[model samples]
Target: MSSSSAVKRLLNYAGEKKILLILASIFSFFSTVLMVVPFGSVYFVIRELLTNANDISAIPGDRLILCGWIALGALILGFICLYIGLFFSHFAAYQILYNIRVRLSKHLSTLPLGYFTKGSSGAIKKILDSNVEKIESFTAHQIPDLVSAFLMPLIMIMTMFILDWRLAIATVIPILIGYFIQAAVFSSDSGRKAMEDYQHSLEKMSASGVEYVRGMPAVKVFGMTMDTFLHFKSTIYDFRDWAVSYTKLCRRPYMIYLVMLTSILTFILPVGVFILSGQPDNQAFALTFLLFLTVAPSLSTPMFQLMYLGGELQKITEGNRRIDAILNEKPIAEPVHPKVASSYDVRFENVSFSYQEKGDQEYKLALKNVSFTAPQGKITALVGPSGGGKSTIASLIPRFWDIEEGKIAIGGVPIQAMATNHLMETVSFVFQEVHLFHDTIEENIRMGNRNPTRQDIISAAKLACCHDFITSLPDGYDTKIGEEGVFLSGGEAQRITIARAILKNAPIIILDEATAFADPENEANIQKGLNALIQNKTVITIAHRLSTIRHADQILVLQDGEMVERGTHSDLLALNGLYKKMWNAHLSSKDWGLQEREVHHHE
Candidate 1:
């Protein structure tokens, strides 16, 4: 995005709460006037005291009292206005920040699932959390301060010009020169590169810190010590080094600006004295010099404030760029005229897909010309070797990745035509990896449906065969799952996830070997529960164990991303194909186990 565009976007955020912003700007302007007025008041008071101290009529007692009162009032009012400006500015800033965060989150939810699949979670988290916070700091504190900084100097210079133009001109020359010098320093490619490097290093450090903390358990389990985690520490040191390098580059220009400002004042003081000493009217010269001395520092204050805000402004620009990238990403296409699907049977017609990567030409097709139908209200099982596109096919049904060629439909309606929420509402998937939030078991199940009553939750758990186990716990349904359901065993966690799906009560269900990790005892219970859950629902199950899918309505045999065979269990067995081979091997293992158990019992 262009700098102008970024500034416009920032202004737009403020414009949303124009009332608070207007109040802030008004108070800021008044604060600037009051702040600058004091410099002139002090100068005039000192000048009058020096020039007419002995003359009773030259400076009246009432005028002296009035000047003192006005000076005191301006000082008090300046601080009050500044306080009010700060309040309004921060209020508007936080509101804008809140709006940006909320908008970004809402946008993320609407974006294509492929966006998240291709992006790093850690990098996105950094942008949404830390980077957004940095922008907020700039908006809340530095931005308002910058406005006041600019206004104070301009007002001070104008007041000085009214007092005496020559001295005012001299005072501004140093500031102009200082500004150019600062600009030159920032404009250098090396300086910009250094700052960019520093920011990147900071991002890397944050990413590494998150990774290191998350992997600490694995690191310890593998007997890796604390020293192994020193990567994060080293990253912090690298960031610090980059920051110091940038600071060193800034030092010379900062010193030059200061020296030049001092030298300009020195040159102006003597020149003013020389011009005034020879003039018939020396009073104007004396007053001008006094005003110059008082106003010079205030005029320079704006430059320092600009320098302080400059770094923050750069960060805000970068942050906005990151945020805009996500907001600007194209969402997945949906059909113009949506087809309403009435049944749960899913079909893929000549479906082909190739993964697309940013800035890469080579596309790898994960599935090719795949066509199959999982009939409604029946258990259709898929048995495939690894990398045979089993999970890929499952993901496509939910439109996680769009196909390059043909269409996938539910009933007769193309899945693409279905709204994302509608698709998700109709389909429920339980993968091998189950994730649960850090909340009570009841709450987690309730997440499946917003207003599920206690009985609804218990009924779903009962359907998953987890209600008995849950009730065995002290808190029953109210038991906290901890983070990602860490407190639950693998089988228990899987059952909870199944319970969640049961609660959702989607028309179609996909179970990717849901009982693959369960023990024999738990597997039996899970099988019983799954039977109850799938009674009236269309089910597509991927099973590693051939025995589990023996009674399925149809079994598909896949190898290398292609369907090798598809038929009922008995038909495939009679054909003596891949399905028959797998079934025979499974039966042989079961017979061998039974024989061993019988021998042990006899002994």
Candidate 2:
């Protein structure tokens, strides 16, 4: 995106508070005008002194003192106005940032789950956190400063030309050259590419850092060193190299810009001398010389601001582009006129789905032309090896990703036609992996119901068989249970998640190996809880253990994204197909485990 377009988009985020920008401009103009007042007072004082060259002491002492006071007052007032303008801009800018963050968050919620899975959490966090923060520099500091920078130069140019056109040329020429040099440094294709690479390196470093932290347990177990942790170490080195290169590229131009600004008097002094040679009025020459000596160098000060703001502008524009890209991502379309499911029965009619890998146009089919009927108030179990589209089927019922072909319906209504919130309300999920918030056990259980009662929470916890363990904690139900707080075993954490699902009590329940972590004892208790929750409800389960789904009303076996078989447990066994083979394998594994335990006991 063009810098102007990015800036305009950023300004639009301020919404109705754009009047603050106008107010800042007015204040900046005043700040510029006041800044010149001191110079004007100094010039008049010098002129008076030059005019009274024969009798310097004859100059009015009161007038000189008044001039000094006026100069001091103008400078103070100028700064005060500038500060006031900044205060408003900063307030408005923060408000805009807050609004944009909120908007982006809500938009992200509407996107498909696949989007979150496909991208790194750290990269997403960087966009939401760091990228959004950079806009503050543009709106709050740069906006007002840029206005003052441009305005001050324009005012100085006018004042200089009125004083002496030759001096104006000498003063402005270096500033113009410096301005172009700064622009060339910031706006060039190579410079922009370097900045983009720098940003990419930082993002890679952030993602790698998060991955490294998460993999620390495995790293420790494997006895790995930093050098062996290739991704994280490489990202660190990449960021260092890019940062050094970017600095090297910018260092020369920045130094030269500074030098050019500081040497404005070098150019004007010679021109002033040349002008003075032909002039008979030595007093006029001396007065003009004094003005050029004081004011000309100060013009370069605004050039400094311009130079600084150039880099900031590039960063802000890049940040705006990233924010806009997220905002532009297509959200799962919500039906304008939503249709609510009348029954909990789920149906997949020749549904096909493929997940597209980012940066590559390749597609991997998770499910292909899958057809099935999950009758209302009955269990439909999906059994398959890992990556065989079992979880993909369960996900389709909730419209996690829209099918590429055919239709998925809940209660005879197409899931896509249902309101997203209504569809979510219809299905409750208990996955193999559960995430608990860093909060009290009671709060975590009550997450399903926004207005849950104490009794309701306690009842759900009791049904999930976690009430006893929760009460054993120091704070009982209120004990915090995340990173900094208490830790629960896999089974215990799973039970808490079951409590959450039980509380939601959605009509259609999906259990993706929910008992995967539980011991036989806890597993039996969890089964009791699931029985209570799934009564008279439509259920679709993904089971790795064939024993758990033996009594399912209908069992569909998936292999490589397509249904290979469908029948009752006995019927599948009689068929002697994939299901029969899987059942035999499951039985052997169970018996082998028991045999191992028996041998240990004998020893």
Candidate 3:
């Protein structure tokens, strides 16, 4: 989209605060005018001295002192106006940014949970952090500075024309040439491609840097250096190389533009000499020519500033387009007449779901014709090999993605009819990967409930079998996690999440390998926590370690996105179907590990 459209969208977010920006621009415009008063004063003072050049004693000393004082006062007032303008602009910009961020975050909450997969997280963060920051930079700094930059030259050119229209016309020639040169360079296909490529490479490099930091533990364990992270290393090198090449390519053109600006006097000098030669006795004309020399070249700085701001505005507007992408994204549609689920039995009937669909090269269903009943107050375990629709089944209960064809219901009511908040309140999730905020342990647990007492937090932690461990820390529940705080082990972190779920105590629980990362001891402890959590709740769990779900009320064995075999543990084994084969394989894996250890011990 065009830059104006992008900027207009940002101003929409500014809402009523648009007034502050206007005020800022007005004040800055006046400030810019006042700032040039000192220069104007210099012109008058010089002309006065030159008029008395034949007799230095006839110089207007009083008038000269008044002019200097006026210059100083105008300079001081200009700075004051500048400060006020900056204050208003910054305050308005910050408020607008805060509103946009909050609105964007709330919108994100309404999107499908699966929309925030691990791979897309970096891009999302950039949109929120740096991309959002871009709009603020454009509005707060650039616009006001552009006002100043724009006005300075216009004011100087006007003053120049008043002094000597000939010199003023000459002064504008180099500026116009410089402007065309900048416009030509900036509007080039190669120039645009260079900027796009630079941004693309920078994002890649940033994402790689984040990945490297995240995988540092693995790298450290493997005794790997920065060079060992070849993808990251390559991205860094690529960014550096591209920057160097782009700079080298643009160097000559930019240098030429700078020459045109710095050599503004060269264009006006010959013209000035010609004018002076025509009026040899006009000492007043000579002084005015000298004043043009001083004032005209100074305009170049602001002219160059305006050009630079224009280029930066393009980049920021591009970033604003990304910000708009998120803002424009439609949130998950809410039901017109929202329904509530009185009973929490999750049923999936004739369900067909797929991440890939039409237009995708691979359109394989993750779940197809999968029907199951996870009855209330009983644990229904989904057991299968990887990619067999086990986790997909668990996720579907919470409506992460609407199925192409299915009747998914909670309490016999279609889930699509349920209000999003109602559906969320009805279900609690404990996935394989645990997420805890960088806050105190108490605060982390309190996220499950809007308002929980310290005692409530401790009580929930105790039920999840993490209270003892938490209390053992120096600060107890007050202890923080992640940054500036202690990091928990996989087991410990999982227990913390379990504690959060217990605190939430939703009637429906979806567990996707809740104990996947735990050690045997931790797994046993996690199971104890899960026991307390799933009591009299509709528990639909996905597990690879079939033994963990051996005593589940029901077992659904899936393969290739279809339910192949399903029954109670013993009943499935007796059928001698896929479930039985999986059970045997599970048993063999344990024996194989034991046998390998025994062989190693013998050796």
Candidate 4:
């Protein structure tokens, strides 16, 4: 996108606060104008002293005192105006940041789960946190400073020319030269490439840092050192190298820019002397020289600010681009008129789906023409090896992603046509990976029901076999879950999530490895909870443990994203097909595990 368009988008996020920004700019302009007042007063005093030639009586003492007071008052007023402008700008800056973050978060929520899984969380976090903060810095601090910087130069030029045209022309020459050097440094192809590389290095460093911290447990368990993790260490070194290289590239141009600015007086002095040679009076020349000395050095201040702001704007522009990618992601389209399901029977009619990565041109088929019927009040189990499209099947029921082909329906209504709220109300999920908020155990369970009573939470907890353990804690159901208080075991956390599903009590239920991590005793208790949740509901379970789904009304065996066998437990064993082979493997693995433990006990 064009830089102007990005800037316009940034302003749009400010909403009504743009008016305050404009007002701040106006105050900044007046503040910039006042900076020259002191210099002007100094010029008049110097003119008096030069003309009087050390005769104190000839010089007006009252006028000199008045000039000093006026200079001081104008400086104070200028600072006060700058303070007010900054206050308004900062207020607008924070509001804009709030809007931008909210907009990004809300858009992210509407995107499919796959989007989050495909992208790096660390990179996303960096954009949302650090890059967004940079926008705030630019708006609140840099914008007002930039306005004053540009305005000061313009106002000073006008005043200087009015006072003495020759001195004004001399002062501007060095500033113009410095501007060209500054532009060449930033606008060149190599300069732009270095900036891009710097931004990439920063993102890589953030990602590497997050990965290193997250992998600490694994590193500790394996007795590995940081030096052994080559990728993480190399990423840090790469970032350092890029930073050092960028500094080296800019060093020469920056030094040249500074030298040109400082030499303003060097050029001004000789120019003033030459102009005075043609003049009849030497006193006017002395006054002009003094005025040039007063204002020329301060002229570089605004230019320095502009140079810094230019670099900052490039980074902000990149940040805006990242945010726009998220905002532009197309969500699963909702129907204009939604249909409601009358029954709870789930049907997959020749449904085909594929996993498509962000830049991939071809879809990787996860499920190919999969067809099934999960009748209400019955248990339909999916038995499969890892990466066999079982979880994909469960995710599709809730429209986590739209199918690439065919139709999935509940009660004869296509899921694509169902209202999202209604679809959410119809299905409840319990996956292997359980996430609980860092709140009270009671509140976590109550997430299933928005306005659930305390008694409703207790009842669901009891049904899920979690209430007894919860009550054993210091605060019972009110106990916090994370760092602040009691921490639940894997089984206990799983049961808590099961309690949430039980509380939701939707007509259709999906259990994706619900008891995968449980011990035998915990498994039995969790099965009891699952039985209670499955009652009178259409249940589609993806089972890793063959023993748990032996009693399922229907079992479908999937391999390589396609259903290969379908039968009851007895019938599958009789067929001696893929299902039978999987069952035999499960039995063999269990016996091997038991024997290993028995031998350890003996030792």
Candidate 5:
């Protein structure tokens, strides 16, 4: 964060459109003095047509119509100062890229949802849409062509040293040796490590083309053809062979800065016409033909506007270093004096956890000195088996990922003292991959109470039985739901995510296996919409279906992460052990599915 503090945070996002970028840099410095005053007006109209060819018939006709109206008003004032300096440099680069995408989307809505599970919704959608459109192509076109490429080469080398200080010291020694050989071939750290290895092979070919178009329907329902899309066609041919070997290694220092700027403008305008034709001062040969026609088109117009803003200033310094690594990350702990509880229970006292990941540092507890509670208004259940930590104790009762050593309360305060949006507005989860948003099943059940109406989203989609297939589709609750809803069915997207956790009447739900992937008649209509959204709330439930927590009032179990066994369901099936071998293997698989449906109802 110091290349002069990343160029002063890209000039403080163009200092909030600093008066239309200082009136587009004063109309790009009077449009580079009307485009280098047409190379000193075609070198004084070819040195007055070769020194007034025998007084060109006594020079009159109103001075040849005042030199054709000052050469058509200097080509219409150099096309109206280059169209008002490219219309105020693209209106101050789209108002500083719409205020850095609204301050990085309001700093990603105050961060901390475990910073989006440590990145990768295609690498945070390629850092919020192609790295904030490469900082809006460097503030709307390479920062006004890098401030008119250093003010048109320092106003054409101070008007070529006031027109002939020995032909501006022989045209600034081959334009400073072709700008130090194009700045040693574009400041090579092997050409910025070949443009950061062609932007990490184009962000790993856009995160393997968004994981091969979202795993193309599970790679065509598992057949996985086209050679399993050969790692997304070899990462788009290794980003087209590293963009043709970084455009042939940037065309050898751009053809050696165009042959050292055409051999220093053809050897300083023929050695300033043999030292101004042995000048006896004919006004120093008309000021060395108007400073060699304003230093020969201001020597490649500021090195072609700094080589056309060197790839938008390297994608605006890699989009302000990926929006300053998500506005300087950190945030997770939060909560100072917060507290807002009003009845949800939860609690996990001598708790401990782990999981860390990125460049590890030894942390894998996944729950250790575990303790439990769940209480306030009933149903607990937890069971275990697979990895046993039971969904990391329901993701630490909503702190998502926290508990390193102890406390995790709720009704008795300490969820780090509360406010993580007041403990996710009194918790409520569901999970087992439900999602749902391509909008409108009453706006995804009014995103759990945005101002839910239309009869409170049809009474929370009729208490999550999903209002008879959402009023039988066809734009019932304004249909839509395509993307994540993918036209429903995993028991209608888990009863539209249990009618968005029963319109987020959140008092503390959790769920996790949420009827695992229902189907016994959508798990008896999702166990009657989870008994009308868990009647007294503070539920919990994790169940790998030991008959859906057989009316759980308390259970526990776990294994690797500790809590050996606890209560209910005939007191853990009268202590036979691991919840009576998981409730006698779910009542011997529901008594062989009711004896094969009573032998198919007697055939």
Candidate 6:
């Protein structure tokens, strides 16, 4: 996105909240203008004193006291305006951030799951957390500060010129030189590149940190050290190195800017003496010079801020670009007129797909002209070796990734024609890789039905054979997962998920090795639950254990994304093809016994 467009898009996300920012800037501008009052008051007081320097008894105490009160009041009023401006900006920023997060989550839910199929979650999360967070700083602090920073300097400069043009020129020249020097350093190609590197390192470090935390279980299981997660460790080092390098790169320039900006009095002092040489007793000019000395120092705050903002603009734009990319991504279009399925039978006709687009040389078709009809109220088992399209076929049933070659329909309605909400409701899955939230057991089971009653959840758990184990716990159904002593065995966790599916009672159920994690006893119990779940439901079961689906209505054997065998258990065995070989392998694996042998070294 163009820098202007990126900025405009960030503002657009604020919607009506943009007006709050405008109000903030308005208040901040006037508050900054009010700051000139104190300068004037200082001048009046100094002039009063210097005019009667030779005779202290003649000095007007009331006038000096009045000047002091007015200056103090103006300073207090300016702070109030600043407070109001800040209140508005902060409110708008938080609300804008919330709105952006909500919209992003809603938009993502509509898109096909393929958008986050691989390792892209880190990048997307960075967009949501860091990229969106950058706007908070921009909108709240920077916007109001920017208005004051620009105008306050101009007001001060104009006031300086009005008081005495020669001193104004003298004061502004050093400021102008300091600004150019600071700008030169900030705008340098090398500095920009270093800043980019620093930002890149931060993103990498953050993403890796997230990934590292997620892999903690595996790290602990394998007894791995910090060195084992090389990528995450390396990102930390890279971030540190880049941060130090960038700081060092800008250290000299920043110091130079600070020195130049602060030394305005050095320039003014000499010039003030030169001007005073012409009229030594001229107290009016002497008082004006004193006013310049007092007020000129305040310029450093605004001037430094202006340069800081210039650098901040670059950072904000870069972050906004990442945000813009996600917001612009096209979601899977909802059907203009959604089709409702009358029945739950799923049919895939001449389906073809790859992880990437077909034109890419690296892409390999995961499914090729794969066609089948999993009839309503019957079980269809998918058996295959690893990466032989078992999981891919199961994923396609729910339209996780849209098929480009052919139609995948449910009850004669194309899946693409059905609304995403409708499709999700029709299919329930108990995946091999189980995922339970950190919520209570009841909440986890309640995920099946959006608004299930307490009795409904208990009934579903009973059917899944987890009721006994759940009630045995101290909190019963309310026991939180991932808590101390609440961590369940794999079998127990898988059964709870099965209970969730039973509660959902979707017309079509996909079981991707639901019993994969269960022991012999747990597998038997899970099978009993499966028996209750599959009754009168259109079921698609993918199993590595051949015996689990030995009596399925029909068995479809898949090899290299092709439907090689389709028949009953006996028929496939008689054919003596891939299914028979796989069956033999499964039987042998189940029967295999463990034995220990003594090692004898023949040296």
Q: How much does each candidate deviate from the true structure in C-alpha RMSD?
A: 4.7, 3.1, 2.8, 3.0, 21.6, 3.0
Candidate 6: minimum summed lDDT over ten consecutive residues — where?
Answer: 1-10
lDDT top scorer:
6
TM-score against truth, every candidate: 0.89, 0.94, 0.93, 0.93, 0.41, 0.90
User: How far off is residue 209 in model 1, in Å?
Assistant: 2.6
Q: Which window of ten consecutive residues has the lowest lDDT sum in model 3?
A: 594-603
| The candidate that achieves the highest TM-score relative to the unseen native structure | 2
lDDT of 6: 0.86
lDDT of each: 0.79, 0.86, 0.85, 0.86, 0.74, 0.86
User: Which 10 consecutive residues of model 4 have the lowest summed lDDT?
Assistant: 593-602
- The Cα error of candidate 4 at residue 578, in Å, is 0.4
* Model 2 agreement with the true structure over 469-533: per-residue lDDT tens digits: 99998898989996455799888888898899889989999998888778988888788778877
User: What are the per-residue Cα lDDT tens digits for candidate 1 across 1-603?
Assistant: 444565567767665675676677788788878876666567767777778868847876676677778888998998898788888878888887888889889888877678887866767788788877876776666656877877877777777778777777777787787778877877677866775676578777877877887898888898876566677778888898997888899888888887766666775787688777788467757766766765576555576777777766766776787788888987777667766789989998888876675356776677878899998998888887787778888889988887888989999888988878788899988888888888898988887787888999999999988999899876888888774443888888888888888899899999998888889988887787777778799999988888788889998888777888889888998888877778878888776743334334554
Query: Looking at model 5, which ten-residue stretch has the lowest summed lDDT?
Result: 593-602
lDDT of 6 by residue, 309-361 (tens): 87787787777766656667778778999999999999999999888876788
Q: Which candidate, 4 or 6, would have the higher lDDT against the true structure?
A: 6
**Model 6, residue 203: displacement in angstroms?**
3.2
Candidate 6 regions exceeding 4 Å error are 1-11, 54-60, 137-143, 180-196, 221-223, 266-287, 309-313, 358-361, 599-603
TM-score-wise, the better of 2 and 5 is: 2
**Model 2 clashing residue pairs (backbone):** none
Runs in model 4 lying further than 4 Å from the true structure: 1-7, 164-166, 188-193, 280-282, 357-363, 594-603
- Between prediction 3 and prediction 6, the one with superior TM-score is 3
The segments of candidate 3 whose C-alpha lies over 4 angstroms from its true place after superposition are: 1-10, 55-58, 137-141, 278-285, 482-485, 594-603
